[model samples]
Each structure stands twice: as C-alpha cells, then as structure tokens.
Target: MPVTHTYNEEHYCKSKRERRNHRMKVGFIGTGSMGGLLIDAFLSSGGLLAGDVIASNRSPQKLARLAQLHPGITLAESNGETASRSDILFLCVKPMEFKTLTDEIAHCLRSEQIVVSITSPVQIYHLESVLPSKIAKIIPSITHSVYSGTSLCVLGSRLEADDRTQLLKLMSHIGTPVEIYEHHTRISSDFSSCGPAFLSYFIERWIEAAVEATGIDHTLAGKLAGEMLLGTGKLLTEGEFTPQQLQDRVAVPGGITAEALNHLRCSLDGVFERLIATTHKKYDEDVAKLDSLFGRDGITRRK
Candidate 1:
C-alpha cells in the first residue's frame, strides 16, 4: 500500500520568510572589555544584526573605538534611550553600579522587556524592585568571542518560554548556554566565566618553571604546555576521559608522572582550598554589601 503525504508549501515558505527577515534589538549599558567582546560575538554569531545593537558606555573613548570597530552598532544618546529601544537589555556595569544604573533606566524599561545582569552581586531582587518585571542574570565569558565558552544564565520570573528559547538560540551560537540557580551563580561564574584567567596564570607559572628546569626556550616551553592543555580540554569535552582517569592513566603506580603528581598534591594541599573558599566568601560578602545598600526593599540605598 502506498501512502500519500500532503506537502504544506505555504507553511514552509512562510517559515523560511520569517527566518530570513527576523531581527532582534539588543542593548548594552556598558562598553568595557567584557561588554565590547559580547557585542562583537553577538553580531558575528548572526543572532542579531549589527545595526540592531545599541551600545552606550561611560567612556567616550571606548565608544569611539567601538563605533570605529563596528560602525553599524547604534550609539545611543543615553542609558535610558538604550533601554527604551531594546527588547533585551544587558547591564555590563560593575555590581556597585547596578542600583544606580537600574534607577537610571528603570522608567524606560518596558514591562515586556528583559533586563539581564552581566555582572555579579546584583540579584533578581535588586533588578525586580525597579524594573518590576523580566529580571534575569547571565555570567558570560570573554572566551565567547572565540565561540567556545560557557554562559551561565538564571532566568527571570516573568520570562516567556518563547523568549527563553530565543535567548538560548541567540547565545548558544556563541557559547553553550546553561541554566543555573542563583544560589550557585558565584561558584559557577568562578569556574566557567573566571576560570580561563586563573588557568592562564598557572600555565604561565608552569611554563616559567619548565623553561628553568629543562633549559628549554620559554617560547617552546609555553607552546608545548599550551598545546597539551588545549588537547586535554578537547579530550575532557569530547571524550569520555575524566580528569581523574586521565591523571591516573599517566600516573602509573610509580612512574615519573606519579612523582610529579605527588609533589603537586603535597604542594597544593590547602592552597587551592583556601583560594576557592576565599573566592566564594568574597562573592558572598560583595552580595551582602550590595544587599545592605538596597536593604530588604531593594530600592532604598543605605545612607
């Protein structure tokens, strides 16, 4: 028996047309290093057109450079105007500036628009108090410019399903979008968003030691270490090999790798423990400081 299938050409054509003409308005309130990187990544991802991006920064010099880099990006007259013109707004200012920036643009934020906090310490409460609706947070990485990073997102209370889907679609083109709880935002941000710099710092230290110990050129030592780390990253991400498994694989019972591993274990006993603990504690303290400023109401600043 032959089954006859009906082709809905009109529906298919309409979908194609929508995809061809779709565009979203994006706004950035700060245009610093992280802020500027995001704009470039977003535009390059083709999620949003450069002309639809509205950028505003405190520094005219930075704005001038950004405009030179991407002339299509709209330079808004004010933060409020940027918020007013955007369907999705990103606050890239410092955490301390969150309250002030929110106060500045709150009146301009439409009820239907989404305001995302790209900085830490500012929570949903702080954003909701003034913006009243669609308050969300994201911790995106500088590595997003390379299209390989983790973007930790915490959705707002009123965000629509369609909106979340659209956001994921736009962001995932640049990096992996992972939803995280606000309580774990600090740890997650530290591990993914802030991990690159921390890793690079250690790599530099290792490279210096390798050059000194082996009498190899610093350039060659650094390149070797970098390639090893890059391959390890791929194996961890693409292969089934766990960090512990890979370590044990190289650290055979009494091999040279084992000796090196043993020294690392002894040397790093409480160093990483305290370092990580301090990171979490610092984040909590900063959040507490911001909370004190906003009080329970999250609007009134501390005198």
Candidate 2:
C-alpha cells in the first residue's frame, strides 16, 4: 500500500552530504484554526523549517493564506498527496471527518510514516483500523503558539522508540508534552486546551465589570487586565508558588484584594463544577457517536 512520491530534482539538499543535512518533511492535512496554529508554532519556534513542510486544506483560500504567510512552504493538491510525501503526517481535521479523511489517505500511508491526529474523540485504536503508519494523538493548545503550556500525547502500539523520541522532541520546542492514559484525554484537554478560552472569558467579563463600575476606557481596562494575566502566568510558571499560595500572597488579610477574593469564591463556588460536568456530558455524547461509527469490539481502553 506504499505510494511512490517524486520530489523536485533541482531542489537543494540533493547531494549525499546535503541529504544528510536535510530535516524530516512534515505534512499537515486540514489547515484549519488548530492546524494552522500548530504549523505557525512549529515554524516560528524553529522546530521545523518552512521548506521542509507541506500542507493542504479543504479550502483553497486557507491554503493560499498559509502560503502567503510562509513563502517557501509547499502546498499539496490533495490529502493523499500530503500523506504519501511526508515522514510525519498530521491529520488535523474535525472529529466527524476522521473516518472519511483516513479512508481517503489510508492507501498512501506507509508503515515508516507517523500519522498524528489532533482531534480528541478519534482515538488511536480507531485510527489503527485504517492507517498502517504509526499513530499518535496529540491534544494541542492555543498557548502553544507562544511556545508555552502543555500538550497531551498518547502513543499507539505501532510507534517505535525513535518515533516517540522524535515526536516528543518536536513537541518540547513548542510546549511540554505530557503523556496520559486514554480515559484521561477529555479531562486533560479540558484543562489544557479549553482552559485558555475559559480563562479568557473570565478576564473579558472582569474587564467589562471594571469599565462599567468606574467608567474607565474599555481599551485601557483590557490592557491592564491582559498585562495582569501575563504577569500572573509568569509567576505561576517561573516562581516557586502554587496557585493557592500566590492568591494568598496577593490577597492580604483585611485588604481590598481579600474582600474581592471572598466575593469571587462565593460567586464561583458551583461554576467550575458545572463547567466540568457540562464539558464531560458533551464529550460523552461525542464519544458515543464515534463509538457507533467504529464499533467497540477491539478498542483497548488504557486505565
């Protein structure tokens, strides 16, 4: 099932010595929001070079936009082409599109290539049925674009030692890679991937409240709140302080900050519990739908 591929004869790094200097050619299928962000993070962080990458999208305009932003990168005419030409292929399409996308490119994927899925609901066992290549699932975050935060990795049975090493090394350039059990994917993603949006929403509302209460300019309020958040993140990451410890340090006894903290604790008491429950409910529904598509007979749950 290995498909043959041809490269430009005039392309650089063709000589034996130059070939040794060449890096792996990474291909991305479906350059939507997360896919595009991952590509940008890898390139901007120097984890991958533009010339060594090929990307394809369902939308021509999206692919054109990527080419415009990154001049030297190659654009594939189809998903099958992207699958056949790369050492590492990333399937970044939606959860529902996984089956059709994998079916389309399955013949082109070789045992030597590593195929990674960024969609959470499509597990490795589901992918194992279709792709002959080594498979992995990486739940990435928007924060990776800034080369920070955690990315969850769950390696499949086919992955070799070297494959795991190479994948983790690439992830380290963008974010810390935390390998977790299959069952933990949903909860882990909720904290790492969805955490950004949740925090941002909270901050947005926080800023709005300040603007309404004091009649301060909205732009100024946003700048103040944003910088506060940036500084708080730096402290949490670089400083030797747990979140609770930092909160205690800032909210001194009988102070304005302490009063605000007391109010917030009361207001947010059941908020997060409800948030997690709601997210997990939706996740269960999605997994149920996927389960119906891929039947549950042989899927191994790591627990």
Candidate 3:
C-alpha cells in the first residue's frame, strides 16, 4: 500500500541531488531519548548540518522537548514524510513498535535510501522484507551521548562496500564501530551497551557502603569512586596488566583491600555465572521471537 504523507516543503529534502549535494539528509522517525542522543552525537561528528536532519515523533511532548533543544531542526509532519525525504532514515522507535512502524512507512522509502534500525528486535531480514532499501542494524548505548561510546553494527544483505565505508565514516566520529556478524550483535550489545549502566549501578552500591563506612557524604564518596574508576579504566586501556596483576597492585596480602576483595571475589563466581546465564537466555529468547516475527509465514504479532 502506498503511504500517505504530509510535510512542510521547506523541511523536506525531495531529490537525490539534494540529499547528496553537500551532506546527506538524515531522517529520524522517533525523537525519544536514544534518538535525541544519537542526533546530538551525529551532529557533533560534523558529518551533518542541523538543516540536513528531519525528525518526527508520535508524541507532541517529545517534539516540544526536542524543539527546545534543537531549535533549528526540521520537524516532519508525519512518519511517511520523514521516510520519503531523506537519504538515511534512522528508526529509533521502541522494539515493540518496529514491525508495525516498518509496515506503515516501508512503502514510502526509496530503493536507494538506507534504513538503519537502532532497536534490537528489528532484524535485517525483517527490514529487507518490509522496506525497499539497504538496511543497517545497530545496538546503541547511552554512552554514545558522550561521543566516545562503542557501538556494534551488523549490516544487511543490501549494504555494499561503499555504503559500509560511508556509514562507518559517519559513525566513527560518535564512537568505535566494531563490525560483527548478526548473531553476535545481541551479546556484544549486552556488554558494550548495557555495561555502563550495570557498572554504574554497581558503583552506586559501593559508594553507599563507602559513605556509611567512613561517614563521608554520598556526593564525595561517589566522586571518589568515580575518579578511581576513571583512572583504573585508563590504566587497563594503557597497559597490558593482567587482572591478577591489577588486583595485586592494589591489594596486599592480609590488607583491608585484599580482605574485601577476597570476600567479593569468592561470591562473584556464582554471581557472574547467574548473570551470564540469565543475560544469554533472555537475549536468545528475544532473537527467537524476532525469528518468529520475520519467518516465512509472516504470522507473528509485533508487540
């Protein structure tokens, strides 16, 4: 079915030449947290100008919020308009919305236009079946907001060498893009994407303990823990110190650090075992659901 669209002509990039003239036209179908962060990072990368970007969201409140932040950006009137007007379209909606959103706007996409899915459940084959375009899938982290975060990219069948090169060139400014097979995208995503939040939560608990143990304020304790983590990260990246060597450098035998480390370390074997098993099992189940959604029968419900 042909999708109906409404757009302000001044905001839409209509032609191939226009999309390619200086910077590529970038369209965002959803302007929620992840979408907004990515738009910020991409603009910071200098690969795109504010005028080259187009955005649309179902929620008026989100549109209002995004407008306050990016006053010069073009807000499309509808999803179909956003899909039809850009060289690269980023679908940043939630996982549950992917199938329905794609089904709605896929017909509006041009064959040469590239559709990139940031949501995990939206697989490449599903996109290929729905849209007449090249597809790229990425799992984004909140860290990308910092412009130094790592992201994983698993390309669809249609994206060629030049497409990959252009995409990587634009993506590299935001973070390191490690290309991997589609199957690996999920677990690697779990690590690089979820690691920051998970580790932050872990750090928060330690910070609370530090505050209680020393009577320091939570803010000061947090700063202390954060600075140590920053330095530790630098050390680990700068040198080839093995985990044992790093531990030894800090915790002497019979010392307070070692005493605590020994206790935590003993518990970690089972803790981490459960963490691994649970994470993998959940991701595997999600992938299986995606398979069912995109299976030959096309019988699956999106949500």
Candidate 4:
C-alpha cells in the first residue's frame, strides 16, 4: 500500500512555502572511488542542483559512466574546462598527479574560485604555489558518503571568511567539519582518513581468530564482529567515558575480560603502540617526500 501524509490545509501550505532552494556550481577533477562518494553525498544533501555539478577525469570511459549515472552532472572535456566552469573546484586527483594537473588548470582558475584539495601529503602551500589561487585542504573519511563521517578542514591563508563559511556549510552536510590548522592536517589524516582501514584490519583479524577458536561459521563471526564494533562506537559517542574508562568498566577485577586483555597485551607486545608509531613515521616520510618534490620545508616544522 502507498503511504500518504494527512496534513491540515494551513500546515501543508506553510510546509510547501518553507522548502529551501540551493544551487551551486561544483566541479570535481577526479571521479574515482572517493570522488564518486563525495559526489553522491553532495547530491543527497539537497543543497546542490544536479545541473550545477560537473566532473572531469583522465579516462573518457570513467567520465562517460559518471555522466550516465548522474544525468544532472556535466562532463567537462578537460581539467581546464572543469576549473573554468566551477565556482568550487575539487582537486580530487592522486598526490602524484597534483603538480601536472594543477599546472594545466592554473591559468583557468579565477580569483573568486574556491579550490579544495583532497589529496594527502600535498599541503595547501604546495597547492598554492602551483595554482596561485584561493585554496583549502580537507581530509575526509569514507563515512562521509553516509553523512556520519568526520572531516578536518584547513583554510588557506588567502581564503576569505565568507568562502570558508560556505565551504564549511557544504561539507557539514556530509560529516562533522572541524576547522583545524594546516599543520595538523597530517594528524587528522591519520585518524580521519586512514583510520577506517586500520579499524577494518583489526576487525578482520578478530573475526578470523573468533572463527578459529569457536569453529563458528566465518560469515557469522564477521557479522558479530561488525555489529559489536558498531555498538562499541555508539557507546563511545553517546556515553561520556574515555577509552581507558570504558576498558576499565569492561575489565572487572579478576574477570575473564581482564584475563583476556592481559594475555593479549603480553602476546602482542605493544602491538597497538607499534602500529601507531609506524603509521605516523610512514606519514611523516611521505610528507617529507612531497615537500621535497614541491620545494617546501614541510607542512609542519618539527622542533
């Protein structure tokens, strides 16, 4: 049966009048996995009109597929065209493609344009040097597609207050947008960008171990692990407990939880600490390489 809303005449009229309209010209240079996800979220948010969004990619086939999927989105012939047409241009290409792509579209960029770089390791300063335009850097998680993610946005030195506000408003629809210093973008990338993969890896290992120990079906183990993780996340968010506090609550004195934790810690030998340390080191190294290629000291000067 089809559902229908029963509304009073006055309330229905007021509701119709209160409907908001938003139209922005947004363009994306890369329509890969993350880029496609962003586009999906933007459209789902209702502020952006289909006709106002455009995208361009190196592969014609990819562009064609996107255009077909999103009939409202325009397909730009090249990066230059995308930059020229968009009020807010998302440089979604890989870090390796940054220099070449920015150089190609730099001349086409306007002073009024809002350029956002989603590539990691390439700092805002490097993007500014290459494009010489108003820019911002954003580190967004995959969860952004579901409007439940977290994002860290760093404004460029040249960005105006209004431009920053607009950017924040747009991104807030997709996730929680925190205004952060550009120097901390690397740290944000560690938690907000790369965190999902790290969490997934740990969950996969736990599920495998559970299967091995209990001889349970692998699918059931996987489902249980996923649900438990989701519930744990909700507990952390809704309950006012620090991670250590939560662990203490679970690890009752002389309980099985405590025993298991003790055994795991001893067997792992500071595994979590090593994982974080190694990840940060690799990120720093990648940032150093990017700085070297772009001729900058680094995103943050470590004392």
Best by TM-score: 2
Q: Which regions of candidate 1 fall more than 4 Å away from where they truly are?
A: 1-22, 298-303
TM-scores vs. true structure, each candidate? 0.89, 0.90, 0.87, 0.86
For candidate 1, the per-residue lDDT at 282 reads 85
User: For model 2, how does the per-residue alpha-carbon lDDT over 1-303 read when each residue is reduced to its tens digit?
Assistant: 444334332452156676457688999999999999989999999999999899999889999999999989999988877887788888999988888888788877777789999978887888887678899999999999999999999999999999999999989999999998878898999989999999889989988888889999999988988898888988988987899999899988999999988998998899988998998898888877877677778776455
Clashing pairs in 1: none
Better of 1 and 4 by lDDT: 1
Off by over 4 Å in 4: 1-22, 296-303
lDDT of 3 by residue, 77-178 (tens): 889888888778999998767877887787677667789998765677778877888999977788777776677898888998988997787788788887
Reference-based lDDT, each prediction:
0.80, 0.87, 0.79, 0.78
Q: How many pairs collide in each candidate, listed in order?
A: 0, 0, 0, 0
How far off is residue 55 in model 3, in Å? 0.8
Name model 3 segments beyond 4 Å from true.
1-22, 240-244, 298-303
lDDT of 4 by residue, 1-303 (tens): 121222222422233235233345799999998788888888887656679798999888878887777787898877877887677899888887787887687777766678998866777777776665688988778988778768889888789998889899999889889888776776677778888898899888887888889899999888888788777877778877787888899999999999999998889898867877787787678777767777765344432
Error in Å for residue 260 of model 3: 2.8
lDDT per residue for candidate 1 within 80-173, as digits (tens), equals: 7787767788899988888788767776665667788987678877777667548788889988998987999888778989879977887898
lDDT of 3: 0.79
- What is the full ranking by TM-score, best candidate first? 2, 1, 3, 4
